[model samples]
Target: MQQQTSNQATRRGPLAGVKVLEFAGIGPGPFCGMLLADMGAEVILLERAGGTFASQLFGGGRKAVANRGKQSLCIDLKHPDSKALVNRLIGQVDVLIEGYRPGVMERLGFGPADCLAVNPRLVYGRMTGWGQHGPLAQRAGHDANYAAISGALDTGRRHGGAPWAPPTLVGDMGGGGLLLAWGIACALFEAQRSGQGQVIDAAMCEGAALLAHGLFNLNAIGAWDGRCALDTSAPFYDVYPCADGEWLTVCPLEPQFYAAFVERLGLAGDPDFAGQQYDTARWPAQKARLTELFGTRERAYWLEVFADTDDCVWPVLSMDEAPQHPHNRARDSFVEVAGIVQPAPAPKLSRTPGQVQGEPPLQGEHSRAQLLALGLSPAEVDGLAAAGVIRCAG
Candidate 1:
């Protein structure tokens, strides 16, 4: 198939000239690759041949929007000649991101020792749940497991129960993928000056702990008890149900904001809530009163009441509502691509803002063109395809 990659260099992002080779994986790995691609990096996804790529019901020839803005080239890594092909690609790319278990990449001959041998300036990024080394480095774990071990899950638990959150956001995307991406960017910048490549051992467990840095100090002083951190226990920081069955969240943490909130609710002069806003002893009564009061009105009423004010209150919008909300609309926080609505590229740069360069690709969609650009003869490419060493899509 004729490719559309010739014009990719025209994008105006900081990483416009960068090249990334993303070894196919799920969750954090793909998300990291997507971030790099969205920032105008030329990312080539090296997908495995004849494998079901399942992550959240997306598998068996169905590509996800999360994988957008990248080119896909399917290759059999177990093939004897695959190392040669990978080494060639390694020599060309500046960054390589892989999210496998601790030693999987080394076992497949794409480890730091192997790739850095081919390209001395290559930045090797490794994403894993437990990181590269530790007691549980090779243990089977997921996002929730990482959060649990990192002590993130222990803080802010409900009074009588230890509820576990889903494994998607905090661990996989935040700690696992996004942390790895940032480390790669830092290494890329340093590589320019040092002319050396380094390995990024990003463990979700450590990343999760890192995310709770401020909370650690709070815990140290005994000021932030685990239960007190829960929004439900605080009058000023909790989500309340509305009369219309919708939800709205409030977070007037500062004294000034809390005073404004209380005044607006017509409870400013009440003895029970007047000057003891920070008293943990009065929190339960205040929270109960606020809950009862907020439930008397619909979300629309509260939104209108708090409009044009810094009450620190807003509706708890779902995915469908968020894109159309006034703030999001004014900021253009979401965009439509290939008929699918999703979040836009973030943290705009003044001179070289990133963009969604293209839609997600079908597996092996650019294999022939990629191989040809790598100086492989058409006959040689065809022979490799015929021998099942590589996969190409028409």
Candidate 2:
């Protein structure tokens, strides 16, 4: 286990020795980079000159939260000088992550073939909505569109109603970014044994479908017809509105937990409630009874009722309230960087703890410094800058 870092530490992090280069893009690419950086990897973000719209979302200058913990290099890939510089960098990096349509990197002359040719040990990660060679590989897509095709969106809504649009959590973060990160980590581990690297094709559709594995298994077992039926299994497993109209969640599914939950609500002694524990025929009535009881109290009252108990009940906190919640405060789940409050690095290790080294850089903020670190001379850096191959924030 790695030692955890105190909030006061300001030097190297656990992933300090790892080097990664990220091609600037939206959704999963930046997210994956952020995850690596949070874990202490030295992430360098390569952006195109004249600024990309994606760069602006994270404060193009050295001030964005998403871009935090990374150095930035701006380059004009079409220029021969820029191409050479990038190739040189690729030769030295351990991992390379990109999110672009298939063939785009090849068109830019930095595809996996070219990148691996320069460095066979480079773990190349590619993120896309479809995949590297699927029939829909060339098509454009967003979070919703990808989820729709993956059967994830289909399993989200209630049975009789139209399919509901799930929060971007499933397709973007879960399927897209997390899958890319997992693939990169696996490839890196394999590289240790094989002394070689490989390309990781992380597609959102496939990842989203993978996330629905349990549901698929249930369907196969004939225990589930679709999304809604399973979602309404128990009064404690769903959301209920309080007297103040705010929602609270309960998930006491285990028999013991369910018994405690019912007892706390003053419904434990009823034989009807006891007999209907697993009765699908009694769901409607059970739901109505629970709803009526919950509706009689305010959210705060319910919170007090479940306080210090294992009833598995909690209020649905708003975004602003979440960080201030007791558990989050105790765990330091959020951090302030450059005046921006955002989530902290997760799955903390006892040793090799992660840290946010610095805020995101402006476009090309570290072009000169990074190039210099790569062994380029001052004159060479200037020449490339003059040739319009690279830009420096200073």
Candidate 3:
């Protein structure tokens, strides 16, 4: 194997040597960059001279978990000299990620074709809610809008309730960011042999639809009514509030697991709970019974009640409680960086484990260092800072 370069030496994952130029954006775009950086990619964030709204709004920049593990260089993309500088940097990087409306990057002179001309092997990843070309491509939207249009959000709520989903997990992170990351990785692998790059047009709406394939399959086969077994319709597969207002997730889907759960709850012999699972006619009454019974005790009590069995029940831990859980602690699933607690890199690689490269960076924290490393002299970098072309933090 080729020896690791000085730049790659500080990093410790499979993508250590791979360089990424991420044009900073909100939502899925930054998330995609974060995932790549966590996997050891040397990501350089290209931000506006002052910084983005999210950079300032979230944790005063430090709490922006998505921007972690990356260096930052603040620049005015609209500056007369910015185009040439960015093109030069493009020639030296392996991938470019941008999340903008359809014509935004093209107007900025850094579209896929523009960047590919600078580096033929560059993998250009585009993240958006509607997609590159479509009737709604130019329309404004957010995570929920994308997921709602994709049909994923429609299947998420309880029957007769408004369709809802977690803020960004469905459309932004899982669908948009993750799909783009996977596409870039695949493109990178293909580039190794074909010696050519390709464009990945990852739309959050399309991604959200893709993520709901299983749900779609069920719907197609009529196996899913709006109030199916797993959609908060079944008493055994839903969250219940305890006496102390804490929550417990009860997902005893299988017969054996359900039997174990009811037995622990002292409902093993109840005529009301004796029917087999999926008896929808009995679900409402069963749920009412379970709700009343569970509300009689504390969440901790129920946790201890089924602690030793395979009841498939667990406490619905809040964000504060999750990190302190025994399983998360045992696996080091979360890590603290620069006083901020966030998730560590995932899908443990036995030979080349991923890691959080560093804390989230301030807007222009790395402007001078990054510019100097990009082959610009200190004098040039300082001149740019003085000219208002870039911002350099002390």
Candidate 4:
């Protein structure tokens, strides 16, 4: 039988011919699958039986991230049919993704060795917080925990309070999930040359450390003191609140940009601000002065003042405000799917840009259809559903 493709009649985008099987878990695995599906790979989510994902039909009232352009197949891996089914799938798919702790998939009989035994060329991508062989590998950890242990958390301390947490973007999506996708892509490329596949041990801790690569400059440059405003604490690289209760962020790091920023803000004549731009002793006072100045005007007023120049000052927009902005609209940075606005596929390709194929699938929504494409008869599909080994959406 021909290998199963996307639920749609024909796949689209740069990865049109690739096939992936994603073991349903949560977090980073789904995100990696999302990237593959976005690029037009045929990604099928292997959900466990008895799960009710459609309860989140609206997916928390917005588009579910990392689940677009894929089909969800509810499979009871404990059932006899499951072994046959997964073995068949492993033979056809180009990659397999799972975000479980190291031993879970091995216990399920779909570990890297198990899958590679079935398909020598299948890339096995695993995403985890610590990794497959570390001391904390089996320990439960969320994004923030991993980021904290990786030393990224300390670098982002918000004044005297806790470090600013961006939900799961840093550790889960950026470090774990995005790195898993990159690992899979790299593995696939290497497979082309060697005709063999391997396991990718993508851990959030490692990825988080990599994400904070720039922080190494603190140690490399001995004179730079973060508390003295040489880094994020810098007066020029701060966010300020405006009169209208909105906010603006500035990052005039370069001398030229600082000049433009100082001139534009009418602070060029102020002795405390002019030649003292980089004086560590003056940063606190200058920050206070700019804070007061920015508080005097609305965000829109300051936006217009530096709109034509690269003074590095702009509104600090929220999620809803971002897509509505002119620059985002011009770049098509976000797209609408199922009447919900969400970010679009990024780092667009020149010839075959990725796109949002569809909304997140209902659990077992494509069970019957995918089974049929896998060469199962209608009666066989029904029998499996009747046995509670599978679910086909009514």
**What are the per-model C-alpha RMSD values against the true structure?**
3.1, 3.1, 3.4, 3.9
Model 3 C-alpha lDDT versus the unseen true structure? 0.87
Which digits, one per residue and each the tens of the lDDT, describe model 1 over residues 189-263? 999999999999999888888887776877788866634534256778887899999998899888788888888
| Model 2 lDDT per residue over 1-394, tens place | 1122233124356666778999988877888998888887888999887776665554666456567788888888888667888998999899999999999999999999999999999999999999999789999988888888998888776555676565666787789999898898889889989999899999998888899899778778887763224655556588899999998988888889888998998888775587746776667778888888899989999999999999899999987888789898888888877666778887787877777777767788889989998899999999989878888886
Lowest-sum lDDT 10-residue window in model 3: 1-10
Winning candidate number (TM-score)? 3
TM-score of the candidate numbered 3? 0.96
State how far residue 35 of model 3 sits from its true place (Å): 0.5
TM-scores of the candidates are: 0.94, 0.92, 0.96, 0.94
Report the candidate with higher TM-score, 3 versus 4: 3
Off by over 4 Å in 1: 1-9, 51-56, 59-63, 226-231
Model 2 misplaced stretches (Cα beyond 4 Å):
1-14, 56-63, 226-230, 270-274
Flag regions of model 4 displaced more than 4 Å.
1-7, 50-63, 159-161, 227-230
Per-residue lDDT of 216-243 in model 3, one digit per residue for the tens? 9989989788557778888988889999
Worst 10 residues of 2 by lDDT: 1-10
Residue 83's C-alpha lDDT in candidate 3?
A: 89
Cα error of candidate 1 at position 137, Å? 0.9
Cα lDDT of all candidates, in order? 0.82, 0.82, 0.87, 0.83
